[model samples]
Target: MTNPCASEIFKELSKGSRNLTDLTGLGGIDIFPGMLDLFEQSGKFDYKIKNGNIDPRLGGKTDIINGVLVITLSNDYLSKATSLSVSRTIIHETIHTYLHKQLSYYTRTDLNTFELLDKYFKTKYPLKQDYQHATMSHFLLGMAVSLYNWHKNFGPTGGTLGFDYYYKLSFAGLIKDGTSELLDEAEELIPPGSSWSDIDKIIQNEATGNYESKGEKCK
Candidate 1:
């Protein structure tokens, strides 16, 4: 099978953002509003989405080049990943973009909150790397909500599984590189004495599973 063209990938990104917007209400949990704003006002925000060569291990990445915001996806990975997985990647990178932008322009109150959280995490997990990922950890529930809604509308599973499934999926890439400590923190948000081992297995399988097998494709 041929890899999806850049246009097709862009279309999927657009649709995914719209799905998140529909699911995330104002003042809701997560950074839904801020993340969605990047797409909703792309011109004003001055960001672009494109497909490019990147590490296969990374689904997507957001960065600034020549003062222009850019979100790049792994062309090689996209050819194999499912549409559902693609949606997850888009959501992940969009949040990164939102956080990146926050660094430059934010209200004092917002900046203070971020600093407080950053300082708290640093103190708690001195080895933690990537402040953005650390910050993203605090918003896992919001990410889970967005992913659950996206799957419900576009996933092959019809998103019929329990909320815990998506909640675990939200922890996909955050459980590594010293961010594991945050996973321990997330456990508090769930039931008492839940087994992350089982949830981790489900997330692992889903990450490598074929979208076509689930009645969806990355076309």
Candidate 2:
């Protein structure tokens, strides 16, 4: 059974996903169609969420067992994290669920271009330790955009937060052994004239700072 706090977090995530799907144009490009798919066909996804003991440093884990997708949010982390941070972790894990579903069930007749690209990357870099993160790095902009929209519509208000902040948050759990190189590759997507060093500082500060203390608690 989902804990009360986990249920609330999932509710917020659903609202954010629905908001994205209901919008049009989306700044001239569909930023998060995969998220739309995950929510729209949620009944078919066999996904579940629960709070549990996990690594202290981790916010959540997406696990596949017996054909089920289980997202476990660290109870300790959730207790301390703000609503926005918990929301980001949910989004990150759900993206992993989406990729697993897409790649595992893909067929040539029904495959989308994104799935094709996912397949190509998996094949090309089969031995990468962070294959999922590597594939997801190519699509961080979409995650960033979705996060910003979610925050704007359903999260805390004020303080001049923008896409750059959420964009850095989107990178929280994605920087790892096989996927760290993609961060350098993604520098092109950063704001014009902004160096990776600038982004690195933002990511570092977010990791170490107590900014979450200032935001609404997930409870």
lDDT of 2 by residue, 1-219 (tens): 356765775766655345634443344654556544544443244578888998876778888878788989888777777666776777778777766676664522225635644664667555332666766666676666666666666776632375567777677666554243434435556667676666656544443336533346666
Error of 1 at 27 (Å): 18
Per residue, candidate 1 scores C-alpha lDDT tens digits across 111-188 of 643574567456755533355666666677667777677677656687676666677767666644533333455555
Off by over 4 Å in 1: 1-44, 105-109, 116-129, 176-184, 187-194, 210-217
The per-residue C-alpha lDDT of model 2 at residue 55 equals 83
Clashes of each: 0, 0
Question: Whole-model lDDT for model 2 versus the true structure?
Answer: 0.62
Q: Which stretches of candidate 2 lie over 4 Å from their true place?
A: 1-3, 15-17, 21-44, 106-110, 113-124, 127-129, 158-160, 178-188, 193-214
- Point out the worst 10-residue segment of candidate 1 by lDDT: 35-44
